[model samples]
Target: MKKKLGFLALLLVITMLVVSACGSKDEGKSKDSKNASGDEQIELEFWTMQLQPTFTDYINGIIKDFEGENPNIKIKWLDVPAADLSKKILSAVTTNTAPDVVNLNPTFASQLAELDALVNMDEAVSDEDKALYVKGAWEANNINGTTFAIPWYLSTSVTLNNKAIFEEAGLDPEKPATTYEEAAEYAKIIKEKTGKYGYFPSMDLSLVLQHMVMMGADLTNEDGTKAAFNSPEGLYAFEYFTKLYQDGLIPREALTGDQRSTIDMYQAGQVAFFDGSQFIVQVKENAPDLYANTIPSQAITGKSGKKTMSVQNVVVPKQTKHQEAAVKFALFLTNGKNQLEFSKLTPILPSNVEALADPYFTEAGDDAEPTDLVRIVSASQLDSAELLVPPMKNYDELRQAMYDAISASMLGEMTPQEALDQAEQEWNDILAK
Candidate 1:
């Protein structure tokens, strides 16, 4: 599963110029004030999406420790409901009252960076600081070689197999497929032996872009001015889906449905494998028998031999008066120590290289839960993990274009190459605007 970030669209947009130099009186001097000793006391406002009562204690602790270290700077924390972030941020920037530091996902961060509303992190952070994070994690929100945010936490999928299904198919439960080719083989065996579908490749319709790239296909030209996924690699990715549908390897419903359909099939015990770790939680609650038969494993790679990651990031607004302090607190908030603590509270992996190297991520102990092994496997992938789709303009439209075209081919509405041609033209058309 992709990293879950709470975002509901009020207005699907973000952009604006930097606000004026100092905080205006109407904007509240509380954001910037002087202490009783006449020392400059800078209050930096921080905004995060949907991190409330659950993380209150942890965030408060970070703020307290940071304030203790940098007495002159105090953080004014605000938690915005995920659904309102887009509209509120767009409004905030337009109104010149944006927060000093904001937590965002790659999608929103990319949009803001495109408008120059966020800080240029590459210019603000030193190479030493950048080196502290995973190469892929840190670059998740880097658009056109310019970074606009600091990496916070990352999420990678863990493919969950049904042990009973595997054993019924005469496949060893202990040795699951590590790549899509092996997975297709397992699918054939499962369908032949057990009469159940193999796996759900199109868990997320948007993931078509990711899958194409994973299969060693480029989505765009050298300068990203034209679509390039109509090449041989792209044709192969399309043909993979079409072949599965035609051969009855995956569920026929997968051609018409998305992630929800995959979940439904898995919960009904009609599919052998699911493509994410979080799905097991639902299975445990909804389908106890399937949950009992669950075996968590690492995600399946495609031809590229790379793992995919989703990141949550932190960005400073270009208009913040406390640039240095805001940046320092952002850095402090995402440091290895703090990241390790957050990772414990959540199943997510740390972006920090040192934090990821902690024993907690590497060793789940002898009596570890199936999930513990899942985390360990996922952590191992971080070395190869990257934001495979990378941030692109009109990404939703691009994903939709690819999804629609590919799905049409899978349904025999068109040939695979024709599907790629249509998708490529649609993408180039969107990019042209």
Candidate 2:
């Protein structure tokens, strides 16, 4: 496989998308499916998130192989946009028409599990099969102790630093910040010495909770029934950002921006380091100058010293008529071989533990491209990665409320403690619903 295949972690912008709610099962026999007695031709509907033009042949070939092996079954694949997938799924369930399988991230997989809309992987898949994937990646799709999805590809952030800016700021490019505190210090020095922003932190809705989790804040109780993040760790997260915004260290738009803004800042040479690797390809294409000076390092952590993991998984809807077949195809699609093959064509990592152990991931040589180094760093980061913000019901609503409260404190509307109190109250109310 080449050093760079394609970049997609960038395409997963909406962190909490809803891919829940399976439709009513169909029992009637059709030409495309089985007979009333239940053994006949079956046509399974499958959905994916935005892989059409670039990986059309790749997916089509997967379907071909699966169909060839199971000659009685056919696959119908549809690629969905990240933003629209949830809405379409909810609509599909209402009309009693839903896909057998879907591609989703950890953010909202729990929502489906809450709705009792997804197949329980703990019962559907065997123990031997479960051991095939990276423990963290595989468990990310788990709700409570029950698994709901098959882990596909995974990604961990690699801090993208501009060498020129570091040099100008008199900071060592070889040693980027390892902790959030160090990152803040680096930002201050970068801004003071180079007159360029040190870093861009997006305090957006989804990210507010994510950052808090990274800071060792547990957002909910053991059963995830209520808010538990109003603790010391959570308060520290708010204070950290609030101080940064007040001191004029981070970008003013940090209050309202998202990762896209962060990417724009890096490409425009407005920020020194971007704690994400998804947009490096963009830097190469739109800002080759910056790309030429791009250096990759492990992402900054909080108290946990762990990087955040981004996992893409596939789930079988709970009530699909062809439950067994749906589960089998999903398993096959995300098996070590298939995942490894897919990772070879993209910048993502395979969740398959065996696939992850391949030399390609473990080694990026001295003469490797910066992008390859990015992979090497990211691969290592996975060893200590996790979905810090565990799955919960009404996740979007809870995060939005918390984000609003945090923003209010940062903008001088309330004290940090007051904001935490308000956020905690709001979270409890949402959980109560």
Candidate 3:
């Protein structure tokens, strides 16, 4: 009787162990069932700079549409103010909590690319996909031969001249200045005839760099290791601005003031021309009288017949868990259809080639408004406008050095040669680091 009872106890213990093992196996299988079925859900975090308050509806609608099409993928969106975007991104990267994808201008993106903190979009994007964007926009995100971001929106400066001011200055509003030299000549005439400042070049906007590039100043030497803007080309560029300042062609305050000062002067009918993005809307809304007399013209071309373009792009971080999904979402966000939709909400131009072909951008009838004309003109110049400052690791430092030299030269504190030499040496030292 004792042996039989022991056998029964052993059987019960074995049975309990078998049941527990089977239950554990079943739970493990259940957990992986979604993966086995290729239906696992993926979550992605996306960040945008200063786009929420104005683009809330558009962004939410996009999110809804994207999720509907890609049921297995979900996007968590965050809108950050433009000023805080860089700081937030840096902090997130340091803490390994970076978003999967984020919006950044090429200038800012270059900084991260240098640190190898972003994915190489060139390898992720196919040749066919690359052809879909504007050539300049597509190339602008390339850092050290590898593209790191997808171009989203683009803005090339166009000349917005006050027709009344032009006429008052004895200049033809219809035949606006097409080059910087011509613009200087026009400025002189306008100031002489109308007793109003012809134009106020926004020096604080770093336009002096654009002017240098337009004058054929090589920004960096071979391999981009040292500064090359101190060459003869750079001297010519600096002297150009110095002459403008010395002759009083541009506003005296421009040496220290921002683009807003010039915009205000333009609105108050104190200036003849204002080169900027599609600002006709602001003029139309703030000063209707000035808008009525505004005429839109093509961007002022340099000797190379190229203008400068400002580009914003979408980029995926290297820390993303879902790279393929993040890239897919980025492509979707920048596709021609979506980009066209976004362009409708703002005056900015689209980077998508197909979007650029839309009638909304191509057509500017005789009866078109000044804003419409500006858009048309701005779009037409994208093919010829290049990013003057390409993606460089030390771009911010280099730009500041160049700007400091320009300011010193304009203020008569330093000769153009001395300023260029100092800037070139400083840039080389930065590169050496």
Sorted by lDDT (best first), the order is 1, 3, 2
Q: Over the stretch 1-433, how does candidate 2's per-residue lDDT look in tens digits?
A: 0112111211121222222222223432223656556768888899999998899998999999999898888999999987778767655643446689899777666666765678999899899998888889888887878788988888898889988999999999989887889989999999899889987878765678778878888889888888899999999998999998888899977888777889888888889886768777777788887888999998888986767888889998765888899999998898878888898887888888888888889899878877788888898888799877767666667777998898899998999999999999999998897
Cα lDDT of model 3 by residue, 202-288, tens digit? 776457778788888778887988788877778988888898998888888778887888788888888888785556788999999
- Pick by lDDT: 1 or 2, better one: 1
**TM-score, every prediction:** 0.91, 0.90, 0.90
Clashes (backbone N, CA, C under 3 Å), per candidate, total: 0, 0, 0
With candidate 2 superimposed using the best TM-score fit, by how many Å does residue 289's alpha carbon deviate from the native?
Answer: 1.8
Candidate with top TM-score is: 1
lDDT of 1 by residue, 1-433 (tens): 1112212221222322433434453553344568888889988899999989989999999999999998888888999999888667777776677889999989867877787778898999989999998888887878878899999998887898889999999999889988888889999989999889888786365588888888899889988889998888999999998998888898877766767888888888888886767565577778887777788887888889877898999999887877788889989999999999998886788999889889999998978766677778789888788998878876777777888899889889999999889998999998997
Q: Give model 3's TM-score versus the native structure.
A: 0.90
The lDDT values for all models are 0.82, 0.81, 0.82
List residue ranges in candidate 3 displaced over 4 A.
Answer: 1-38
After superposition, the stretches of candidate 2 with alpha carbons farther than 4 Å from their true spots are: 1-39
lDDT of 3 at 88: 78
